[model samples]
Target: MSGISIVGVGNMARALAARALAGGNAVEIIGRDRVKAEELAGTLDGVTVGTAGAAPAGDIVILAAPYAGAAEVVREYGDALRGRIIVDITNPVAPDLQGLVVPDDSSGAQEIAGLAPEGAHVVKAFNTVFSHVLAAGPAEGRPLDVFVAGDDAQAKARVSAFVAGMGLRPWDIGGLAMARALENVALVELGLMNHSVKHTDFSLGITLLH
Candidate 1:
């Protein structure tokens, strides 16, 4: 089983932690508030908790925070996160939920990658899936699609493995530059959910007709 550490104790954190536990991965919750981290960890089996700034003990670390918070966490960790695959799962959507907050030239994942430690590879994934859908398992009787992008091939592969282990599909959409498109698509999905779709339980995936 993979060793995974998640930063933040919000809905996304809880959802991801639950999946990680179910996948038999060793999970750790590290939050800014130690009390909340401990509380969340206590609710999960074989999981641990720690405060922020401490060295991460897992090979894979998921940043289950908002776009701004994700950047701050990466900056704060600095070299302490070296040699770890840091998964940036934040969508930089506008507060009004109408569009993306990031410029067309960049993305939340790319910006977070800029602040990551030298050897800490930032792979974008899970931004397109909602927390509730993740908790409920596969979407529309199909496994969730996790779109991943990163500069490092090995890093992306590791993240893909983790996603597949959790019973989801990991689609490698190319290098880190593609993250901008991923975030933009997520914004579009939000728009659909708010207007036409009118639901948060759907996930986007390609249907192969072989």
Candidate 2:
């Protein structure tokens, strides 16, 4: 398992960090507020904390913030993030929950990729999985299905490896262009949670018949 640096102190960050630690990877928490970062790190044994703007110490950097925050973090990191695998886990749904905020042709992950440095490979994943579901472990003993999309093959492979190591299924859904579909799936899941299903601890999964 590779070391992971999560640039947020929220639920998603903690959920990912817990999985990383479980996979024997060192986890680092970086946030705009050093105190919040430290507090979150303290809750997780063996986790390190760093302030925002510091060069990420991990090979994989997970932007666990909201869409806007994620963009700001990437822009603030700038060239220092070159050559790092940036995991874009944000869903760009409208605040009203009616639809997506991005244009029809582009997805949040693609937009974030545009903001990244030349060498920074952006991989879109984990947006469909709810934080509470991740925290509660696999649903009904079935591993979560994590859909990943990225233009960089090696970066996607790395993310897939990490997901597998953490006992989840990683489905490579092709280039970053596929992120639009992935983000739409996230929006659907959110709508279900907020309406039909009314649950926050459920995750989307695929079951194949034997």
Best by the TM-score measure: 2
Residue 204's C-alpha lDDT in candidate 2? 81
Per-residue lDDT for 1-210 in model 1, tens only?
A: 889999999999999999999988999999998999988888888889866998888999999999888889998989989999999999888889877787778888888888887888989999888899888888557778889999999999989999999988889999999988888888888888988999986878878899
Per-residue lDDT tens digits for candidate 2, residues 66-99, read: 9999999999999989999999999998988877
- The CA lDDT of each predicted structure is 0.89, 0.92
Model 1 per-residue lDDT at 77: 89
lDDT of 1 at 161: 90
The runs of at least 3 residues in candidate 1 whose Cα sits more than 4 Å from the true structure, single-residue gaps closed, are none
